[model samples]
Target: MEKGSNHTPKALEKMRQRKWSKATRAKMQGKSHSAETRAKMSASHSGKTLTPEHRENIRKALLGHKISPETRAKIGKAALGHTRRLGMKHTPETIAQISATKLQPENRAKARAKKLGSNNPAWQGGISREPYGWEWDEPLRESIRKYDGYKCRVCGVPQMECDVALNVHHINYAK
Candidate 1:
């Protein structure tokens, strides 16, 4: 509509005259648009790309939006096994990006610091801090690693491939 013509007396009269009845509005409430209308709507949005600023605006708008528990559960249930690459491996670039992200020990500490002691799932009422008559030194640990061919006893990962030292747990846990 022409900007100045929209609120003209004739246009106001036309709009007031075209108001739908309550019954007509009720009938349209649950009804969808016709195929032609849907096609026109789709065409109007086709080939339109959001500008970077618009995309940033959208991101900022949704930054702190919270989903209710029920909505989150529904979304999770709907998303189960629906990934485009459900069972595929991450590409090398993704793996590199992930490794780079995890390279900082400070980030790992900051994350775990929130869930230590009583807040942790394996808290065990602080029993983990109690030594179970076990006092193996670094030399003993090295011997155990040497005995195990310098690789992970379970997954068989080589010691050199591990970022940290190989842990040799007690026999009960080594099982």
Candidate 2:
């Protein structure tokens, strides 16, 4: 007969009926999913996630779609080139189709820059900027030379190859 007594049961029912989004479910189950279940889920989820009927409908819709012959040729050429460059025996037709799609110039440049950046020493686990309190002294420099085989560890061009004398680097200057 108490008005506030209803609130406690209502809140408990609401908590029991709580629904978690897929992301929240995933995070809550973090690092605890069984390997077999995880593998099954991963394999099942490895697609566009469209139903067969929906995909068929989309296919029917695009049945009359047209692309320029020149665009088609460029895509085929690029796919073939990729296969040759990668030494791959087979290039997926789906990959060719995706590449044929239009992309912004900036997006293309960013992709190219990313690919190039991966090859650069500074980006590929190489040190950037001078170390704190870096200095050159006889014992320290000799230790550096010995540790690095008298070569620049970052650029790998060799300390002897450097026009400027290489300096000894301390990992923790405050220490």
Candidate 3:
């Protein structure tokens, strides 16, 4: 479901013909959800992209609509608190609820599957398992460490602070 692409006539007709259950319609009619439910609903839709057809339909629907003054005033009134809420911090419970689905084992497995191997952003064509170059000996590592002042080049943590000797890394990861 991307921009510039749309369903065929058959698919569109099928979607149009789909009917909601009476119970579902009754449940949704003239009813507003609690704040927690609203928050959860908002969180679920956060990263989804609307297709171009949906955008066009919305544009066409609003093209010639005239807003009555009373309706316009109500809309403006409702938006007044939106700016105030922009920088508000979420409570611990809210944060936990938003992240609950992400912490589930099935979701974790799906995320891992999505990012595996060549699909991953950091993928380097399986070079990580390659053996080091012949010249990569312990003496050379020690020399490099000594040359670097026996500290981590990135974090500046000295060798003595670590339980083990500092590890020397190849900058280009060629080794």
Candidate 4:
């Protein structure tokens, strides 16, 4: 289908509900755009920028969408054995040059500044450093662990069987 074509809500809903048979899907699998068509498509989108309203609409549409496990597995299998820049390596001299550039005082200061306090994009005003409530004591934690039979809730692995310590996580972090 062509990009950004307008359709009625009913038509769009119908399209969403429509499913193609395997034969139809197989027939379309290896199709490629003609050079002229490709040029036209490129020209159509060359200078387009989505408006805030359009961007918000797209965000809302995709807000809670999830990939099915079958689709996830297909994506994983498709990417298997792919190595980006395979066999590429920096020479010792090139590594030294890179190290020297990064170690320069100005470069070090810039990197440090990016991660300092509220200057960091991810800073949350030290909220994460606040202590847990009084109800979240070690005894409460141990009781919860015992209630769960001392096993990982997600993987069902017993604490005794795991190489690392098990932790109880709050699924809903509303507080």
**Who wins the TM-score comparison?**
4
lDDT of 2 by residue, 1-175 (tens): 5866555787777666665556556675747778999999999889757889999999999998998999999888888746444654436876776676537677788767776755754584443433433444477668867787777656666767778766545333432
Candidate lDDT values, in order: 0.82, 0.68, 0.86, 0.84
Tens-place lDDT digits, model 1, residues 40-151? 9999999999999999999999999999999999999998978797689999999999988877899788878888889887778866536633455688779988989988
Residue 71 lDDT, candidate 2, scale 0-100: 93
Which candidate would rank higher by lDDT, 1 or 3?
3
Cα lDDT tens digits, model 4, 88-167, are: 99999999999999999999999998889998888898665356665777798788788888898888889999886678
Model 1 stretches astray by more than 4 angstroms: 1-28, 34-36, 85-175
| Ranking, TM-score, top scorer first | 4, 3, 1, 2
Question: How big is the positional error of residue 146 in model 2, measured in Å on the Cα after superposition?
Answer: 97
Q: Give the worst 10-residue stretch by lDDT in candidate 2.
A: 125-134
Candidate 3 steric clashes = 0
Each prediction's TM-score versus the true structure: 0.30, 0.21, 0.32, 0.33
Which 10-residue span in candidate 1 carries the lowest summed lDDT? 127-136
**Candidate 3 residue pairs in backbone clash:** none
Candidate 1: RMSD over Cα atoms? 15.6
Model 4, residue 20: what's the lDDT? 60
Off by over 4 Å in 3: 1-24, 80-175
